[model samples]
Target: MTLRTKYLEPWIQARENLERRDWLSKDKEKEETQTLIDKVYNALGSISWSANIRGFSNTERTVTLATYCTDEWLSDIQENQMLDLLQRRLQHEPGGQQIKVESVYFYILLKRGYDARHFTCIWETRHALSSGLGPSCIGFLVNVNRNHWVAVIVNFNSRSILYGDSLNQEPPNDMLAILHWWMHHHTGHRFTTRSLEITYQKDAFSCGLLSFNALAHHFLPMEYPLIAVSNVRNGRLKILLDIIDQHLDQAGVRHLQGRTLLTSLFDRASSPSVKNISSPSLNPKPLLTLCDQKVLYLPKARLG
Candidate 1:
């Protein structure tokens, strides 16, 4: 299906239909559906903002299901209680991680007394091998009312850090380029998809290479060092950074900073690494990256 028909139209319809529904009567069945519709509307609003940054201009881009639960019923009491639990947990946590949004969504639903679950999917090019390549796209599949719901949550886990040294394999060129563009525009760090190629002569490993988009300012201690290589040929880009790390300290910092080390291989025939290397060949120069970060400059009360 076209991206518009798949992602944008459905969400628009869902939101409109949701806004028109009456929920004050509290009929059990209608209320249940209303709750789900509310969640879907809110989730879509979140997804749209997220996708806008990734250069996905088409509103029809659909959100894939991640994981979901259908057995439990939702109630206000349960939802409020869960929200309290989540608020307390987040109090001790650091901000800016991708999963934080997901956690917030999960807690919001729970606090609102809805039974929900999470599911993830990856968007892959026709060339990607189905077996081992990680999901190109990932998001949660929520059980709203009695129906299933899908909403994209880009940047949900995009901040994972990858070490610069000890890379062994290559990743898909497009993936690296997009990611590089995203990190630089969204975050303050200026990193680049340096190169992607094959390595490990004996076993013949395909890897994706990336480095800092721009070297750190001389005065700064280099708070974040960019380094990542993924095995796109074999479809194990998700674990690329962890495998190449020489020290847990470096790797740990990257992981905590939410810098991504994973790569997506959308083609099976050409090693993902090969795709990365050849990207510059096909496209004269890298496209100007779009900034995905949304800065909320208002006070807390103003936000609501």
Candidate 2:
């Protein structure tokens, strides 16, 4: 049977209206909402969490995900922290121990005058390279001057860098050169750079998710599904849930489960438009394997 536009239009409209509006309580007073928020914050205990997650402060996590509870561009700090969390998740997955995820800060440090030699020092301090922990695959989420985000995967087995950009654009030449130089300097071999044909994001804010999914697909394909424009809202919710799940301890999880307010709040906030419609199946097109090799050269301009 042919699909009916009449039946599908509202669903499409609902996806477009992705922002959650009912964050505050609708009852006589907003006491319930405030209480729930406080509970979440208390469980998080930002000071201790920051010490554990390196630098991802409590305020950064709660403010970014709690305020809107909707699709939004991840901030630099959020993305980096999320990357660290994802790396933890990946390592636990079967066969994921072979993969290593580089911090977004690595790229940031390079941008701030660090060189290939500095990476050698960094790897030493992190105890990644010094301890004979040779990962077959390495993932990098590069932030291009706070303008755009991209994922670059260094596959040691293939001796290649797989580039993923949701905007269907090439990574800047200088950035590629830096990566190329880093690989050759550390491993003593030139690695080929190739682009991955990832699904193009239809909206602006989903770049972070897309870049993240690129790494997710490479390391833990079955666990973390690929997301594009169609299911990006659900994607956002899934990520939020994952973050909350990872940080919450058994006691905290039980505390959250004991209350209905938090669940109700998430339900109300996430399903703003479509109350009855189930989420669409997220089947994405197969990524094209054929892509031109990107030959890079070190730029004359020095790192700054």
Candidate 3:
């Protein structure tokens, strides 16, 4: 099947970007990228041709991911959906780091009501507290007036909440109030809150991508630092490829062999996008680092 025109351009642009960046120096690296692109192309073709795919299964989710990979912005809810997938992967990590990824809806619900009973129930019902104790840390994204996105990570280990905005703006007061109440309810005391040092977005429409990067920056033990703002386009492409790679793996089609999406990503050792930052380090042993859609550490303990 012919790759759709919409998808064709993105893949072509991705190939061009890879070559222009000189990331594919070796023949093996070039071949690997081509194979990965072919798989993404095939996946895009499959979903475009499939019938009656109404639900947001792995296959259906590909549509949203494909759009994102092509440098389009996604809704707050869509960002949460992608985060949910990453949350699942994080759970399977080998370490004892217990992390909770809250949905944008979770924040929405907080806005509607601050009932302690209601939230406590919701937390328990959703298994937010795995061992009858809450998770080590809770991370979530906030949609600022439905216009821009920001990432907030509450690290119980450090007893601090890091608010990350690519625009370097202060967090909304109401949102901070909700967080203050929520944390007190969970821990019997207020935790400190501060702004996380984040890469500024050079362009609009990349906050969602940067939000993902922020989460990875504070939690995942990535070999490199946070992705630079200028490289967010490439970041989106890598994210889309990671989503496609996982979808193919889940659907039992992992034959195409070479460097994994992240492996290939790190191949660009000289790319300025992999700039370092001074932030709290996570357990350097996460079985899976956030491939694109991106941890926290705390001891197991009962909530107060």
Model 1: CA > 4 A from native: 23-304
Residues 1-304, candidate 1, lDDT per residue (tens digit)?
A: 7533443333333322233432322465455544454343333232221121121111211122100111122222222222232233334545312122132144233323222222122112111323323322222222223221212222312433232211343433433444444444434465533321112222222211111111111001243223222212112211211222312222233222221101101111211222343356432122111011121322233111
Show the lowest summed lDDT stretch of 10 residues, model 3.
295-304
The TM-score of predicted model 3 comes to 0.63
Tell me the tens digit of each residue's lDDT in model 2 across 1-304: 2121222222222223332222423564345434543444333322121112222333342323441234456766566666877788876778778887777776666554345356544555235533557788878788876877888888877889899999999878888877787676667789998986466788777788788887777677677667646655456555654565565541244243232212322233433333323334321110000000100111222110
Candidate ordering by lDDT (highest first): 3, 2, 1
Instruction: Highest lDDT: give the candidate number.
Output: 3
Give the per-residue Cα lDDT of candidate 3 at 110: 65
How far off is residue 177 in model 1, in Å?
45
Name the top TM-score candidate.
3
TM-score per candidate, in order?
Answer: 0.18, 0.63, 0.63
Q: What's the true lDDT of residue 112 in model 3?
A: 55
Candidate 2 pairs with clashing backbones: none
